[model samples]
Target: MWQKSPNHQSLSEEEESKALKKAPSLRFRFILAGVLVIGIIASLAINLIFDYSQKLADLSYDRLLRSALLQMDENVGLIRNEVSIDIPWSAFATLAQAEEDRVFYKVESLEQGFITGYQDLNSFPPNPPVLDQIQFYDQMFSGEMVRFAWVQRYITDPETAQTVRIILGQTRLSREEMAAAVTQKAVEVVVLIALVAITLIIIGSHLVLRPLHRIERALEERVMGDLTPIDINTPKETHHLKVAINHFMARLQANLEQLENYTADAAHQLRTPLASLRALAENARDIGYSNSASPEKQHQALESIVQQCDTLSQTVTLLLNQAVVSHRLQTHRLELMDLLVPITASCREQALTALRQGVHLSLECELKESLILGDSFSIQQMMQNLIENAVRYSQQDQDAPAEVIVQVMEFDLFYRIKVIDYGEGIPESEKERVFERFYRGRYDVAGTGVGLSMVRDIVNHHSARVNILNTEPKGTTFQVDFAKHRFDGDNQ
Candidate 1:
């Protein structure tokens, strides 16, 4: 019923293309993840470098403002109990070292109101500093960010004391430029490192996946329909994959061999019957044309043609059953089942087939159930073929009463099935040859010679043994023995 399509190859190719597109590339994913991790780490490093540079730049410039404030504090005096001060030239000179920056300074007396330089500098709310101590702060003055250092001093002449404040501020142009330069250098180094890491990621991923590429190339180079086992050197990680592929190919090779044999045998065995049918049909046509020939002769020719057709149909059926059993032996998984089921079923079917021969077929299964690890389809095929072989040979003698007996017996270690036929027994010389494909004995019986061959194959598949023995008076008994405990421990 299941036939291979004419365009099966093309459809498989299309499906393979779709599958490749849908499958994610392992190398590409690894590289992408590595790049993403490098990008995140590089960004964090850049931010940390920027912050460190900004703090370093600020530390360098704050010392200059403090020196200028200290110099101005030393120049303050308390003459006539009133605040008086002379600003030092060195204080302003030190502030002028930053060429691109603007500077501002102020000196004031708290109790006596505004004193010496830059009264408008009061825009910054001044916090009183500890005596003789310097305090630094920053603020926006005249639309520019400024850094300021403040210092306070008290002068006493035994009459009255006055508190004076010295403050100096500078624009932050040079400090900002220094921080930007340091950050730019660090960023360049980080970008270079990231690029190097990404390049290494690509190379490493390629090396790790080289084995897979080798396997693909090996398969691509093989000829189509080559089911031989693949032999190639591979790493331990991929060795199991190679083994699995070899196993699959071995099964496929076996199936193809079975199909080829079935096709050839079916053609060879069916040829004679087909040719006989054609001859009978031609003979019947000739008999009809002859006026001298009686109608009874034409009827006899028609009957012979019908008989040939039946033989052809039976041969075809046996060939198909052989093919089905061979295929199932390759593909079907064995399971725990009762062996008696197929045996009884085969007995019933063969009994109906032998009814026309006036042969009495009987089943003798004493056990309720005989459990075994086996493929049911193959077991059924074996039973059917064995019983059919017996039924065909049992009706050889027309004088004696024909009888075929199918028996199932169980033992401690194994199970035995026997098909006994009361017919002209087979000689010891031809017993083994009868199991060969299309090898029939010299008996006038309707048969295709495929049943016994199928039985032999099924027996070999189950690792069982078969024997043929002559009965007491006149008959042949085909005995098949199967081990009961085969693969039972493996299941556990």
Candidate 2:
């Protein structure tokens, strides 16, 4: 017994691992797809949240500026027919609570000079506001961005009333701080949700792909020679893969069994012929050593040895031919061809051999082309075997030359090949047994009995049929029929 070295085994294992790593992983792809989807949604949400937060901050702060202006308007009164106003210091107190920001207010008469408050705070609306309506606008003042509110008041002092305008401006420090705080809080929430979604995606992908992992482990743990079908649960989507793998294993198992049987049969068939050759050689050696041996006895022993060698050679040749046919049938694919080509070639190749044996081998084809789907090599071997078998048995008598004719004809639905031999026809009871491996009906005939068996194998591989029929009066005919339209290229 031999065992593989550890280093070689480890090398092979490493190679397998490399191959698996190179393969595209479904789990990784699934997770990547999920991550991409989540990323796109998160980006859109962050952008929208930023806009919403800024709008909310502006709405909350603008109300404070408007309230301060309204309180100042109530203080303007018409005293002595002239505009008089009492400045309210409490209005500034309300605006200072939100943030440390600069406040500027201006109270003035449109027709008169400044009344009270900052004279340089000129930020105002282009048009006077409607009565009881406060207008808000933004402008750059004193090198700082400010929010301003404007309102109009008609005050009478009993001498002459003047139109009073009150304006209030505040810097934007508080509004920016509030907007940043709100946006930060929203981003934190979005980050938490994104993390949770990514976690769930990883877990779900693992759960979905668990069945495939189980299948891999099952295959990896099996013995090298195991050919049994896998018996594990799988989802509906993966069922076809399991079925195909099992089918391939079953085919491999069948081929292995066939190889074992063929080996045993070949050994059994070679044993008898090899033993006879050894015995004849020993007898020839003994005859040469005998002191009283005659020339006739010595020649007879040599002749018998030569005859056994020929038989052994024929047996080995037939066995080899059978092996080649079997191997080719498994490996070769069939193609559209004309059956008459191989038949004519076989007749031509075997013509000299047949004439030497006092048998005339001839070919007769009535049709110009008899097409069938077949492997050319196997078909040629089949024809050669059939023609040789016919010639071997066609010698009826030594006085007249025996006739063996190979005929190719196209019938209504199939192509037929007939090998006719005018010799002692097979008995009805032994016609079927004649095709069995190594089964010889007549010991006097010089053959290995494997030729007809190989012919039958080739016929079956082509999905054709073969039959042995007795010719009228005294002869045997081997007929083979091939379906004309089974694999026709024209029909396809």
Candidate 3:
């Protein structure tokens, strides 16, 4: 008993289709997008923090100025109208010293409207009572820049409707100091927030992209020839990557299988012809020495020797053609007409040989002009093999005629060449096997069994298709269809 080979099992068309549907990998793209989003958010947050800090500083400074103005108002209201009440420096000084040591106070008398308290008091601007609204103003006093809050009060004598203005002023050091502190605190907070945000972003990015690192490692560990499916089950966002990798592996496995089959077929076909030549040579040498007496006998032996040599030569030629076509399939440029002309010429010679065998050979070309892109020599060899096979197999029945027909038709997008032979046609079941190397039909014929197989190879190399069909009356037809090519004459 023998175990079946793994390659013997056919791949399901559905599975192959699904493999093609696998999504492409986007791990790097995902990471890049995430980084960009994080950067944008961080930038926006930093700007907001700076704006908020400046607003807070402004609010704190305004509040300090309002508090200073309220203190000055309270002191001025205590002045008596009956007599000029001079305010003690200690009174406003105490209030100013409580918040800021660098305090300045100024008061101008309402009675005489004269400079009072300090000579610097005359430099202070008088406040308007109705203009008690908080406003920031700048002034130069004692040759130094200073900012301050001032308030004005009215003292009315009961007997008179006249009003006297008493002005009180103080230095703005406490409010300025408060504004500075608020600004410094806001700067520290912004710095701390930025640091925290940067740290978190770094950590988040790594966590988000950690799965990609696993995929990379898995890929690196894989062997060059290993086409096994990836084992990792990724997140939904990363599933496309899994699908793409699996698709690539499937194609790789398929190509590898095809390579293996080609290699095996080549070995099997070449081995027998080589062995036959070797045996024939050895036998010829033996006969040469054993029967040296008869010249006629020697001549017969020489003819046999020549026939064997011819067989070997044909085999080598077919092999070389197959190899050349396989190579040209990868890298070659050929015009359609160039390939067809040579193939037709080669097959005409084979058709002439068939005529001696009592088989009629006919050519029917429906198109005046046709062209394709392929390897010319391979196409020639393919045509020769098809014609030879037809000649060999066309049954010679005295009652019925034997004939081989070659037809070429050109359609809008393709050119089709068919070789039809009227012989014992192939059974439907065996049609596919005719293209396998070394596979022969039930009919007895002198053949290397590689003729039709070579035809199939050459057609495949040109990215074309071959159809084997039975004609209406009798015999089988091998149809070769060449796909259309887009070409600019200059490029060719």
RMSD of each: 8.6, 7.5, 11.0
Top candidate on TM-score is 2
Candidate 3 lDDT by residue in tens digits, 147-239: 555544454456532233333334445545655666566556656765676667667767777778888888878766777888896788678
Between candidates 1 and 2, the one scoring higher on lDDT is: 2
Model 1 C-alpha lDDT per residue in residues 349-410, reported as the tens digit of each score: 77778887788899887799788878887888888887777777776776545888888899
Error of 3 at 68 (Å): 7.2
Q: By summed lDDT, which 10 consecutive residues of candidate 2 come out lowest?
A: 392-401
**Any runs in candidate 1 off by more than 4 Å, and if so which?**
1-17, 28-201, 228-232, 398-401, 485-492
Per residue, candidate 2 scores C-alpha lDDT tens digits across 28-78 of 899999999999999899999889887887788888877778777878887
Q: Rank the candidates by lDDT, best first.
A: 2, 1, 3
Error at 215, model 2, angstroms: 3.5
- For model 1, what is the alpha-carbon lDDT of residue 189? 97
| lDDT of model 1 at position 258 | 70
Error of 1 at 288 (Å): 1.3
Model 3 spans with C-alpha error above 4 angstroms: 1-44, 63-227, 232-256, 316-408, 412-415, 420-432, 442-446, 454-465, 469-475, 481-492
Better of 2 and 3 by lDDT: 2
Candidate 2 — which pairs collide? 78-156, 78-157, 81-157, 81-158, 81-159
Question: TM-scores of all models?
Answer: 0.63, 0.67, 0.56
